[model samples]
Target: MPSGRPSGRVPTAEEGKKPGARSIPPGLAPRPRAVPDYVVKYPAIRSPRQREGYKGVFQDQLAEYTELLGEVRTAQRRLRETEAAMGRLPRHATSRTRVSRGRDSAFLEKQQRCEYLKKKLTHIKARIQEYDRDARDSAVYF
Candidate 1:
């Protein structure tokens, strides 16, 4: 077996600086600094809110984004529930009874609502992105 001990003689310049080799001094290795939990929890939002006019616009966009995000989540949950309910109800009948028709109509209504909410959410997200770009551009100018 090969010995694990270092042959501790410093090389002269004529035989030094081998390719892909490092020469870190003994006991001088860098230690990792510990990051605070608060910093991780509340990492800075890197938007253009530092500027004057763009701050309000960015804030408005952020607020709208939060609101729409909540609405989208609710819509998604309700859509799932509605779809489940629709699946539980009878899809076809021998005759078009009033109860069956009502159930089908309710299902169709929920499907329409789900589609509408999805489209609205997409539009809101696009607007938020546009506002973010605008804010960044304005900040660059100032």
Candidate 2:
């Protein structure tokens, strides 16, 4: 035993937690407390137009937004595939050591496709970002 220390088997972090500690994390909402009877009797009115944390995108407009998000994801996947295909395209050199017609044409086509996809992706992402921000505008308050 050391000075000002207890002589016992010490607990490790994985084994157990000390007293007055929470095992699991709490959510963003304030902890529940015993509300005074008077306050409860005269509780304020809160208009719940939507559910808390509407990650589900429950609104009608949000349904379209969700679909658009899915499309964006699909487009991103296509873009990656296109870029990969571009990389895998074969390069044939002529006797003068110049990149041949077949490779050049294939590479240009792939490059153009990639550029178009990139621009489209950027536009869609911007729109989705604005929609996300709009969702955060309205709120429920105390």
Output the number of the TM-score-best candidate.
Answer: 1
The 10 consecutive residues of candidate 1 with the worst lDDT sum are 93-102
lDDT of 1 by residue, 1-142 (tens): 1597777877796478787787778689888897643334323334444233334444565566566656656666776776666667776732234334334564556555555445444444455566677766777542
Off by over 4 Å in 2: 1-97, 101-103, 140-142
Best by lDDT: 1
Candidate 2 per-residue lDDT, tens place, 1-142, comes to 5586886888787568767776555476577897543343322223233222222232433455456556555655765776566567665422323324234554555555555445444443444455556556664556
Candidate 1: RMSD to truth: 17.5
Give the lDDT of residue 42 in candidate 1: 27
Clashes of each: 0, 0
Q: Which pairs clash (backbone N, Cα, C closer than 3 Å) in model 2?
A: none
